[model samples]
Target: MTRAVVLVTGPDQLALWQPLLTGTERTSAAPVVLRRHDRRSLRGWAQRVEMFHKEDRLERLHELTGGWPLLVDQAHRLHTELDDPDEVLRRLAGLRTDLTRAREFADAAGVYADPLLAAGYRELDKEFADGSFDWENTVTAVALGGELEEDDAHRVIACLDALQVFDRDGVELRLEPLLRECVTLRT
Candidate 1:
């Protein structure tokens, strides 16, 4: 028997890929689903990262980037880029993950010509201003706030996911507190 394992990061990607594998499985005609890990898994990842990098800075990296595999990979690169953990973290903390990420997503999705994504992103920026951007309420908040529709919310969320602003889940969303600080900066 042949088996395939796919790593899906967010809802949009899942929607994109799930259709392709609808009936390819041998025994079962249903699509296979896998559960993602919780934040607790970060501890083990932190240890592994610490060992690999030979830097006792995974905890700090996790504090900044969270446990998402991609973010961890970025952290690893950042680890190689700088000698001091404090300087590395300062660089990370100074990033505008929101803006840069939005641009990347828009470019990737070929939506740079459209203002909808930018407008939706600004709505999210406003939402993150005084309080938190609730993952669960993201669509509703943006829709109700007249920034975007539910469908557009998915696109915006996809952008944010790519940027590591929010870790997307089916029913709930998790925010990386450190990056969230960058998103919600008042000044």
Candidate 2:
């Protein structure tokens, strides 16, 4: 008799299982990391949006989103409700403070249901409200005078990255311009 139990977390279980279960005796499947699109790749994604084939519009979208795929996808989804794609794209680009839009993003991104992530966001939100966006310091504060371990802080930061709440390049962590503006307005 054999018993097997499988536990999976996150939005994509297949993304986890694909590499782990595909290894053979002598060869292992190469891991694939799906990164957010950069400007050039974002241009390609914009072009694929139905009826949006103009180069100038694509350029505008690229400039607005800074190559963030979720922002690009949100703009693409706006075409149906609004008459002018360009106008709608512009609004979506600048509408981060809209409570409705924020809730939509949180829901779609699954951050709304996560208490740990919510706490982290609250801490960062307070820092943003205070005109200081020092994420490293924020992480340290959240960890409570070294009470929490470093790995836990890293995991929180990683979750924030996955939520597109901010960008991390090596040691530098900064909020996206739009998110900063939104936080400013709310405060």
| lDDT agreement with native, every candidate | 0.51, 0.58
Candidate 2 C-alpha lDDT tens digits along 92-145 = 765565776655555545444455655666666655543444557767755663
Model number with the top TM-score: 2
Instruction: Compose the digit string of candidate 1's lDDT tens values, residues 58-142.
Output: 5555565545455555656876777565667666554446566534433433223235444555566566543554565777766
> After aligning candidate 1 to the native by TM-score, how far in Å is the CA of 43 from where it should be?
2.3
Tell me the lDDT of model 2 at 36: 57
Lowest lDDT sum, 10 consecutive residues, model 1, at 105-114
Could you estimate the TM-score for every candidate?
Answer: 0.48, 0.59
Worst 10 residues of 2 by lDDT: 17-26
Root-mean-square deviation per candidate: 6.9, 7.2
Error of 2 at 149 (Å): 3.6
List candidate 1 segments past 4 Å from native: 1-39, 51-58, 68-71, 78-115, 128-137, 147-164, 167-187
